[model samples]
Target: MKKYLDIISDLGEGFGSYSIADDSSLLALVSSANIACGFHAGDPRTMASAVEKSIENNVGVGAHPGFPDLVGFGRRAMDLSSWEVTTDILYQIGALHAFVKAYGGELQHVTPHGKLGNFSVVDQRYAKAIAEGIAMFDPSLIVVTMPGELAEAAKKKGLRVAYTIFADRTYNDDGTLVARSNPHAVIRDPDTVVERVIRMVNEGKVTSITGKEIEVNGHSLLLHGDTPGSLQLAKQIKNALMSAEIEIRRLGDWIN
Candidate 1:
């Protein structure tokens, strides 16, 4: 396999068989998939099918756990306690794991989805609880987290952390992701996203929304399948990374 970063594709809420767009794009570019685990988007059938497809394409499978908020699409922040967050996360991961196991494939990692992910980065206690829950369930499973804060918290909790960057999102000067509510937060331009990622991987720097240089590290890159033109973006990103001779790997491979 060609050694620089891992790429994961996110399959978002209630995406059933009709998620052909997501399925096709995920199979084509990503080495790993962060599949929605019921709470936010997928049903049992959808989870099973996604796991089967991942196996068929030799892609790594990961549980994408989110708050139980299908109505909000798990985007709205909830006032869940750390215990509640842990339980919600475990429930989602366990359900997805059962499906993957029944299909005779292993779940390689856990990535908190949507609002839960954002909260985990800023709330050390919440991040610790999530990491602890994952470690309790399967110590071998890698925890895919935003680079810096969340990763640091997971590491402290004895969970293997896969520091991730977003291929289609903007960053702030503080190295945190720009809030999604902001107009410039999502990188909609395919060429611009590709250019930014290239600089991040090759130069270890990203130009934040404020036009300030910020240092960042990425073990994996994510493409949100829900975004407009997500499929095209994934294809372009894969091609650009290959042209730059950066190897793409699954989070599992790195953790193992």
Candidate 2:
């Protein structure tokens, strides 16, 4: 049987005077949060406030590092060297870790944000660079994402690894996420996404965009915070899981 999951979402995505979602409200729903670390979508004040909110709600805080693409919101991939990727990861982790420590909370994990995240899944060099940075921090730090070369790289470095399944994104026949550029890539239908989430938790599988069953279960489920009615969707998923006798817990609690 599939184990219970850790439902997590992105926090600290807003910067300056702009806000994407009500993170304070999101904290009350998710068990963990991937707070943006200024590269992709957060500023210093935003990160600090996010840390405080997570601490208040007892939600696990993690570093959400991206490709330093503030213009594209980290969704655009950048051509970077292995060294650049390694240092970027370390820099972002350290920046978030400082706030987490100041607020008397632990940095639960490191989840690469946006295209940097997707690249690590298929690119061995990117995976290794990210892994090397995590190992430098503390070889046992938890790394959360999909099961791929990233997880493998972390395991080889004595780091804890946990996979993530997107609650709204569709997978491919090869088990990778369907490129977001495609119109059908994101399942905006709340009912459909909710049902797929339950199936993944209970059956350990996700139907690809091409209509194939893929082994895509994970310890964590990634929910987008910026989407409209996101909190309502989160509530639905949480309620459904609870009704089905599944415990919604922090990803760090069950990371391997």
Candidate 3:
């Protein structure tokens, strides 16, 4: 059997006239796109453009919901009730899905953004709330998450889960991502990132910050569009995966 891997990137992370990353270039290399909804780094125009571009590229369009922290880029944690989290997620997903619908495409999945994503991994309440929001929106939507609280919650909700690993981020010994506050949390070397991803996809293991090999059943590898030299790196990673005989595909097509 041929091993499959999906490369996804966060996109439409621009507001008004200010843009971040070359979405057009990144879209060409990625198999899936996690389009930012209006909460953190997107607006109505940006969302619609992202959806249309993603559809044109034949990429899977997933909603990337974040906390309403535009200044902080949704990387800062927020204090909110479970109802708030669920409702906020539902709203964000709905807003993006509208554009997808207008573009004659269905949403592929949901991946929480930044701090909300980090919290959902460790906090069960947040995990359950996010799962509830996604299920409420569409039970058929795949939940792209790490192996943690959110994964468990999504599974219990009968939602298909696509376990993901960040290609540019480092992991802790316990399987959670290392905090971005740590200077070494993100690995910028393209060669190293490609090597690690190949290993993780083929061997189901990733090396943590502590240099410990941690097992991870990853179906998707996430790349950040905003990272410097990211476009070239994404190309290299895609080439490396192809060279290694791994199939690069959209998650919605195969994840079960």
Candidate 4:
């Protein structure tokens, strides 16, 4: 049997007059796009453009909600109540969904961005709030999650869950991503990234920062658009996966 996977990239991350990644090129390479809402790194114009392009490319559309930390790029931690988290997520998802609807495409999934995503991994309150917000919006939307509280919360809320692994980020022994504060948290080499992704998909495991091999449920592979050399890396990874005989499909199409 052939192994199947989904390739996704964080996109629509440009603010007014400043763009982050080559979304067009990346869109051609990825099967799914986690578009940024206005809160973190996008505005109405960019969001609209992203939706249009995603429709053109037949890529799955997803909302990437995050903390209202533009200066910090949603990487810095913020103090927010559970209600605030839920409402903010709902608002972002609604904003992105409107564009998706306009473009004749349905919103596919919800993947929390930056620090909010990191927080939800261990903090049940944050995870539950995220799950509740997503469930309230549309219980049918798939929630892309790591091995963490968010996965459990999504399950409890009767939402579909798709497990994901980061292609450019390192993991901990417990299966959580290594914090960005750590210098070695990100894997920069394209070859290394490709090797790890192949292993994760084929063997269902990842080697942690501490040299511990940990199990991973690899449904989707996340490639950060903002990473340096990401376009080249995405191409390499895609070609490598194809060469390895793995089928790449959009999560919304096949993930149950």
Each model's RMSD to truth, in Å? 2.0, 1.2, 0.8, 0.9
lDDT by residue for model 3 over 80-126, one digit each (tens)? Answer: 89999999999999999999999999899999999999999999999
lDDT of 2: 0.90
When sorted by lDDT, best at the front, the candidate numbers are: 3, 4, 2, 1
Model 2, position 165, has a per-residue lDDT of 88
Alpha-carbon local distance difference test for all models: 0.82, 0.90, 0.94, 0.93
Better model by lDDT, 1 or 2?
2
Candidate 4 regions exceeding 4 Å error are: none
Residue 58 of model 1: what lDDT? 83
Runs off by more than 4 Å, candidate 1: 15-21
Clashing pairs in 2: none
Model 4 alpha-carbon miss at residue 175, Å: 0.9
| Residue lDDT tens for model 2, 22-59 | 89888888999999999989999999999999998999
Q: Give the runs in model 2 whose Cα sits over 4 Å from its true position.
A: none
Error of 2 at 197 (Å): 0.5
lDDT by residue (39-92, candidate 4, tens digit) is: 989999999999999989999999999999999999999989999999999999
- Order of candidate numbers by TM-score, starting with the best: 3, 4, 2, 1
Candidate 4 displacement at residue 203 in angstroms: 0.2
Candidate number that wins on TM-score, 2 or 3: 3
